[model samples]
Target chain A: MAIDAVIPFKPKNPKTRLSCVMEQEERETFARAMLADVIAASCEGGCSPRLLCTAPYLHPTAEVCVDADGLNESLNRVLSAASSPLLIIMGDLPLADGAAIRRLVSTEADMGIVPGRGGGTNAIFLRHPGRFRADYYGASFLKHMAIADEAGLSVEVIDSFRLHTDVDEKEDLVEVLIHGRGEARRCLQSLGFVLSVEGGRVGVERRTHKETL
Target chain B: MAIDAVIPFKPKNPKTRLSCVMEQEERETFARAMLADVIAASCEGGCSPRLLCTAPYLHPTAEVCVDADGLNESLNRVLSAASSPLLIIMGDLPLADGAAIRRLVSTEADMGIVPGRGGGTNAIFLRHPGRFRADYYGASFLKHMAIADEAGLSVEVIDSFRLHTDVDEKEDLVEVLIHGRGEARRCLQSLGFVLSVEGGRVGVERRTHKETL
Candidate 1:
């Protein structure tokens, strides 16, 4: 059976870290672009993606589950009712492609974790959904591993650069420009963001002074 | 029993890619620092680390295995005669600390692979050694996965930024400066390399013009 992927998204005020370089609307657009990439990659990996949005939002590719509660509460609500395998991935991993998604879903363990930079749990694959619960934020990777152990579920950790590089800080935009190939990259490029090298360091620079605020 | 870690080291002409920024001797010194860091991390993770050196070199900590053959041939020679659980990790992953090593050694699967940035296997944890051979070049991550599947051994992929970020190119030095806390970072800093921003991109720059070449 096809694994169901639930991507939790904050429709309002997303990507706030990019506020120094991107306007509010631009951040929203970029967030949606990343979400689109995630959904497309999930589908390509033979899984049906469903967006767990905090607010009402429209996406043509995936199903939307609107729940205004906190992340852990809402995700557990979904988990409690899940019957088959579930893949929970963040919306900001623009570098993740079908290959990464395929590896996550193909794990034989009861639970699989793809940890993000700075001890964050970016993506998770659960064979038996209700057997595990979600607990994100602040070294959540270690917390999730503990949760799995407490539940008596066998766990596997996936060490992937593409899956772990979740776009958050403005500096992280460089990775998207370097490795991303979806609408997110186009959105950044369309906004005049280009890769620049300053004193031997690779970063992003805006060529044009057009602000959309 | 504690897992035995085998770290391959090339004593002569190592890290040639950093030749533009670092001299040959400096590269060798930096490589040794990284090796020292890896050995320390392995020991801290409760594993006995052995340095698989291309030439006879002295390490204060780990035992040395002198093998003049190429990487594949030498590692295979060791893999063919393995007894207990073994961990094969590259010496270039200086950012990998005790926690990362601990996670790698604690996996429940037959084999756990930590892949490098570009389809390279950086580390492998094998429960039953001699069952799986070592293949370490050009998309060896995927190749190892296939080999495991062919051998009917279950596999788990560990997605870790510190473990996957192997220092190969000169640009990779930035990660060492940012996240590293060992002799490798100290070596780079002692060589006058500092984090600099070029047109908004983060990179390494030499503040002092003390060329060792």
Candidate 2:
């Protein structure tokens, strides 16, 4: 089975939700980092994906095909073209790791579901890639599972930290800062993400619930 | 007893993260709307927060002074002066419901931690008001809990969807679009975050695993 790595690049205006927290450059930087992560994972796997769909407007890169269609259309177009096993990843998932992707692709099951921490679908894979279509985000994890059941496809929910977090807002970035350690560390201190722990304590303590509540 | 409500107001900038997906003015407008959500929540509680901390400045209506200490320092000033109960709500936690706040406060726990589906604290209420001095974002959830323990105070993790899912990215906006049936329902749809799932599923569905792993 061929493992085709796909990152859904939604070039929607970054201002959509919690994205108001960082600058555009930072957001772009975040995307660049995610792409780097995908590249790194691909390198570890030592297998170049068959196709990569992104914005047609961006500069050409190795194995990346700029999908001229708008965000969702591009994703759907790529989803329709999968001839082998397909691994659909979110471009916003900075925490995605190579090991997780390899594990998911290596699975015996015909389908894969990786849930975002907030009940959204972070990453999904399918043996019959082109035929799979459903709501991309939101609480779509369970929905996809149900569809697989109806389709009679064996499904697997790969438990992974890398597949669980995707950054699209400021707080999501904060989550990266909090959870990412070592190389994957969000480099919060360098990125100027705020954290004020004085020797790991607030230092100010008082007791008064009756007074306020 | 002072209940200082900490909110971060984002200034209009082309560099802000939201700008990546939206125009600068659009980003600011979105940020303000989130601030309004907090303001509304505080109003429902019948107690105005002592301070409204914005990025690089404090609100004109606020008493505490925050001269751009970044998010960390601003929260520090408020937490330091919080001799009474302190309600620290994210500006983007639009789904945070008044009932959830009431329940959290009613518990009268030493540290009220409303963990986001992503594992971060969404709405945190300190009964001692000034007992927590740890960082605000990232892994600080677990870190702050440790801090409370070190300070000889109790810490309770309260699970509330309203308090946990703060909007920071586009996918979060999609979450609001999918599950906006709650308090922020109209607000979500009105903001142009519409994704017609066409009624398939709300979240991730299928799971494919490697047989070897």
What fraction of the correct interface contacts does each predicted structure contain?
Answer: 0.17, 0.08
Specify the highest-TM-score model's number: 1
Clashes of each: 16, 45
Model 2: how far is B92 from its true place, Å? 24
Candidate 2 chain B least-lDDT 10 residues: B203-212
Q: Give the runs in model 1 whose Cα sits over 4 Å from its true position.
A: A209-213, B1-57, B60-163, B166-213
Kindly state the number of residue pairs that clash in model 2. 45
* Tens-digit lDDT string for candidate 2 (B1-213): 335566555554522544445567666666655666666666565446544444444455544444556677777776887678777777676655556666666665687776654445666778786767846655567767778888888776654445666776555665555433444445444444445343432321211233212
lDDT of 1 at B151: 93
Give the Cα error of residue A147 in candidate 1, in Å. Answer: 0.4
lDDT of 2 by residue, A1-213 (tens): 336677655333442454555456655555655656655665455335433444443534446677655555676777677677777776666556566677677778988777665557877778887667656544567567777788788887665556666665554555555545433344333455543345432211222344334
Score residue A138 of candidate 1 by CA lDDT: 61
Kindly report which residue stretches of model 2 are placed more than 4 angstroms away from their true locations once superposed.
A11-15, A45-54, A57-61, A70-72, A181-189, A197-213, B1-213
What DockQ does predicted model 1 obtain?
0.11
